[model samples]
Target: MQKNSFLTLSVAVLLVFSLQVSAQDAQPEAGVTPSSPFHIFDRFGDWARLNLLTFNQVRKAEIKAEIAEERLAELKAVVLEGASEDVVNQAESLSTAVAEEVETDVSRLDEEGRNIADLTDKFNQLSLRHQAVIEEILEKAPAESREALTKALEVSKRGLEKAGEVVLKQVEKGNLEKERAEKIAERTIEQLKKQVENRSEALKKITEELGEAPPELQERFNAKLQLLEKELVNVESNEQFKDLRERIREDLKATVEDAREFRKMHNVEDEDSDDILESISEDGAKVVERVEKILSKAKEKVAELERSVAQAQTNGKEIPARVSSLLDAAQKHLTEAVAAFEAKNFGRAYGQATSALQNAKNGNKFFEDEDSDEERDENVLEKIEEANKKIAEAERKVEEFKSKGGEVPAEALRVIEEAKKQVVLAKEALAKSDFALALRHAEFAKKVVEKIGALLERARKAVNSGTSNTLRVETKTEVKNEEVERPANTASSAARQPQVRQVKITAEGFLPRELEVKKGDTVVWTNATAKPSWPASAMLPTHDVYPEKGGCIASAFDACKGLAEGESFKVQFNPIGAWKYHD
Candidate 1:
């Protein structure tokens, strides 16, 4: 009886131990359903999804490929247009390489399907190439060149939409699937293991860093964990899982931040810490697509404006003065802008040209408004023009007459007489208010007078024929023997003889025309005559001398400094005799 009781106790103990193990295996207490907040891990169930995680990389590569193709096309255009062969070839080679790289990226998707790092690196390199192509095209093409830009923009936008679609697909591929119902179960088991390990690690780290945890925090955490384990097999509420994830993540982040802050406060030296520069570049194709859309819109607007302006101009039956002026201004601005652009005064030129274009458009719009009376007095205009032309001709004739000597030929006088007769008749008509007849007669009369005067002047100048012989005079007390010996046949009509150094000199209308002298003789002269001794000219003999266009004497009046034209310039010669002098 004693042996049997002892065996029964051992067996019962073994059965209880087995039952506990079975229950533990049956429920992990952290099993999350698809509807649970921690259901994000459901997609990670498949071995293929877990291992082949290069979708991010693939998305990035697709963008790069799109950009590369865009560049290759641009390069091809340049090459076709007679660009440097080497550059074209280089572009081709690069395109080929990029193509291969893209192919390699796609090929390796099976091996590294969700690798974000590979995608990022490869995408970066490809993106650079893509950007290079776009920049090259943009740089070569003027900003106003819309066609190329439009096409490029369109390509970019399409690429972006496509890339977004690809990325969405990639994210979907990383999620829970219909075929993997057991994934949730496996994740729950893994999460439990992770939580235990993390808890142990945190406790150790907290102890080392903070020296100790407050008693209250430890007790509360322990209670929460116990309660969480009570509903092991079944999830009681969705918030429970959500709260658990949040509380754990938040606690960890806060702990790390607190430790760092504490170290700083205590002046602890932690050298391993660094300021990490994180660069998260978007996919190239997507960026291109967005930019292209903007560029395309701009292009369309510009085109529409151009077309509208052209149509407006074409529709104008007759351009108004104000509108024409505005157009002219616009053209000038455009021309200036083009010149500026050529000279590389890029900013100023662009502003001027754009302003000019806008002004032109405004002018065109104004011209489109029709409000002009297309009526004119054609006969009146003709008569007025004819009268004006006759008057102009008369003025020209008068000028010609003045240019010659004041004389009129007989033929010209007769012609003038006839014109006067006609003028008299016209005046009679004008008295009766016959404006057209009066104007016609007046024009004839004016022309006749002008022609007569011109003819008279020409005849006078022809008749005079004054001698061209230039004469210069020199005077001295000691006369030259050669001058005395000179033939007295100066002119048959008028002759002058030197009366043995006895010349009674007197200045009339002006002082003697002498600039310098040192004669050893005292002489006296008076204002003896009103007329000038020499025949200067018929037009202005006494008032002024030469044709100095703008009026003024280069030298001041000689009264203060020396003497005026009417005054005696006293120069008492001291010793030697100075002969030649000029005014």
Candidate 2:
């Protein structure tokens, strides 16, 4: 009797273990939608599988790509079956999340000093497939679902970018062959060409449908379609595959933005004017908040300048007359901004605040001494190192705060992200021996780190006080050499005397939209719109389109951060290629 009882217990234990394994491995059978009852089990399986491979980044990334593909399939299935808007959105969001996960995993592999070429190549192919699928779905999706699908499409494009970035990094490290890289670039360009073609065709169809529409509207549509066709021709004929890829990427981005704008412009009816007004009011409130934040930052900078001036005097160093004048102008603007803000004139306040910040930056620039190439290089290197240290410290503080149960504000997170971008720009600038620009980027990054420190402290205080509110603060300072020798200029002597050109960032976009300038020419973009704008080299967020590689993310042509209203950012075009930029 005892032997029989023991055997029974063992069998029961084996049965329970098998049940647990089956549950953990549960996956939806064929034709299951995200809305189905068994979908939760499918999600659990994905999560379990992902967690199981956490230690294997390459494999994890592969799994993530697969999961993303699955999500995309679910999205297509649900859309075809007329899922509810919420359900569709959920599926799209899941697809985005999984694609982003793949990106993150690949990044981790790169960071771990592992070989990422194969994984990146795999991801690149996956992204292309995803993009094609999303585009097809976009056509069949309902209007409500179109927006979410568009977002998913953008995310897939970013995945492609991420994969390309890895491939480029590996090539630079000599881990990837040039032939392979070129092939990848060619593939991406081909995909982009297809996208441009599709967009042009859609626009043409829309133009046809506007048979009896207003002449002005018809004219605009025709003009846009013609421009797209022209770009398509350029993409196909360009022999330089890399440049072709970038141009086509920009084409797709512009097409997407224009499509959204066109929809917004024509979708509304006379009855929606009230809703539009409400939206305008809400936007105005956000602008007010942004202006207030700028004002606070300007105030801090002006005060720091004041302290620096005092220190200069105490050290028996004569303060430059121009520096004093700029400081006074900054203070004057700050006072006016405060007054305007108090009077609820947010627009005026924003202008004044931006002017104050610019003046403060100008004053700070006076303190930076001119240096020879060697000195500049050394100084920039040191500064970049210092910036990295500060970033490390800030990251530690953030982790500690989180460990202590602190809820980091979204604004603080954004600041951290900006700080990282600045550091990257600094490093890129350093790589090209653009020491002044490098130092400027590094200094900006340092300032951002300081701002993060202050924000985290404020957050900590709020946590301790059992309050959820924290004051928002940000500061910006620019470093410029009043007179410095150009680095390795190959332009003619006459062209070596750099000329400054102006581009206005208006509500409609860059005023001139395009410009042709000789080498050693500087273009300054002033923000004329109410909102802040960031101007950078194209290929979007990475900004590494210039042949000269080294600027945050991709090239040294980035503004690093947003320029507030009434402020300006300047970049000197170098190396004589047809460069593209966007805000």
Q: Write down the lDDT of every candidate, Cα atoms only.
A: 0.37, 0.61
Could you tell me the TM-score of candidate 2?
0.35
Instruction: Indicate which candidate wins on lDDT.
Output: 2
Candidate 1 local lDDT, residue 424 = 52
Give one digit per residue, the lDDT tens place, for model 1 in 291-385.
22323333343444456556756987444455556556666756655564454333224334444644555554443434332212233334445
For every model shown, the clashing-pair count is 21, 6
In the order shown, what is each candidate's alpha-carbon RMSD? 45.0, 30.3
Off by over 4 Å in 1: 1-132, 141-146, 175-583
List the lowest-lDDT window of 10 residues for candidate 2.
470-479
Instruction: Report model 1's TM-score to 2 decimal places.
Output: 0.17
Location of the lowest summed lDDT over 10 successive residues in candidate 1: 272-281
Per-residue error (Å), model 2, residue 470: 61
lDDT of 2 by residue, 169-280 (tens): 6766777776676677657655655654554455454333322222222333332322222223222322323454454555444543444344344432211222222222
Give the TM-score of each candidate: 0.17, 0.35
